[model samples]
Target: MKLALFLVLLTLSMSTRAVLDDCTCLVDCKCKKSLRPGQYYCASPDVDTDSQAIRNCNRDTGTVEVPCYAAPNVSCGGLPYNATQCIFTESRPCTFVNGKRYNYYLAVGLSLFLGMLGVDRFYLGYPAIGLMKLCTMGFFLIGHLLDFLLILLQVVGPADQTGYYAPFYGPLVSRVLVNGTDPFIESSSSCTL
Candidate 1:
């Protein structure tokens, strides 16, 4: 009788234990594929390259349907949230859509330090332009200046094999920098494949 009573108590105690599974899907927008249809991946201001959008695959449609941007504020209370707070500054891992990504800092560094050598173009897979810049000293230095401006303007990001521009600092890297960790890694000895 005592053994059975002890077993019952053990089972009851185990069941009573609290399990916290607070999956904040809306507070932080992230893209994730869902097996079930009608599960929409909604991102505020439209989905961008980065995965900073709500990934709640089960948000009900109609009156109960909550938007990624609107969910956080309404859930947090009646107070309005700052627009900047919604921004996330973490870069998505590479291999995101055919391994297309470029380092923003590297392009800027090359533009500043090696534009005359056309190293930036070479790095960006523009071998012809790189060669021209190399031979003509960055198009007699005019192209070099223009290239620098373009790089800062985000007009000169590396292209994927498909020739689509792959910018390093996109929606993914728009998060607030905390403790020096962001999309563009600064202090890594080896590159992430």
Candidate 2:
């Protein structure tokens, strides 16, 4: 039948020119082809050239790698890239040192509703334990329930220690244990009697 419709329109124009030559666009803005093959859709005039931003096509230096909010000094842990909304996140939420960040849900909502007026130890600056928990009112309440469980288990931070500020959602409380793996899982097999 006419040579099988000319070999099915030359195999659909050679697989649509090899999917438009592997979705070209080496980044100069306005590419747009991504249906999820190699991913391609530029328009990043530093994150708002009309906001397309999908970026991922450097199949051997084809280029497209500048959008961590334009790179330079790229911060997330110390939080600065215009205070983050995510151009690319590894998840850091807070770390600021001298400038101080402090605000894990406003120190657990001022240690759970004003913490017997110690005001969460003066909002975590610890002004002499917030004047001794406002002259023992909170202390009489057992230091306002142990300072609301040590500021909700963040273990009472911020007297310029610079920690809390994480709550984009809730419940973080890390206290460091990264890459951990040796808690006595029992593997001592070496008896050479």
How much lDDT does each candidate structure score?
A: 0.47, 0.48
lDDT of 1 by residue, 51-163 (tens): 32322212121011222222222222232533222211122223222234355667778988899889999988799999999999989989999999887776666655322
Best-matching candidate per lDDT: 2
Backbone clashes in candidate 1 total 7
TM-score of 2: 0.26
lDDT of 2 by residue, 22-135 (tens): 332222121111122112111222211221222242223222332222122333344343311223311111233223456677778878788887888887788888888888
- TM for every model, in the order presented, reads 0.38, 0.26
Residue 167, candidate 1: alpha-carbon lDDT:
44
Question: Which candidate comes out best when scored by TM-score?
Answer: 1
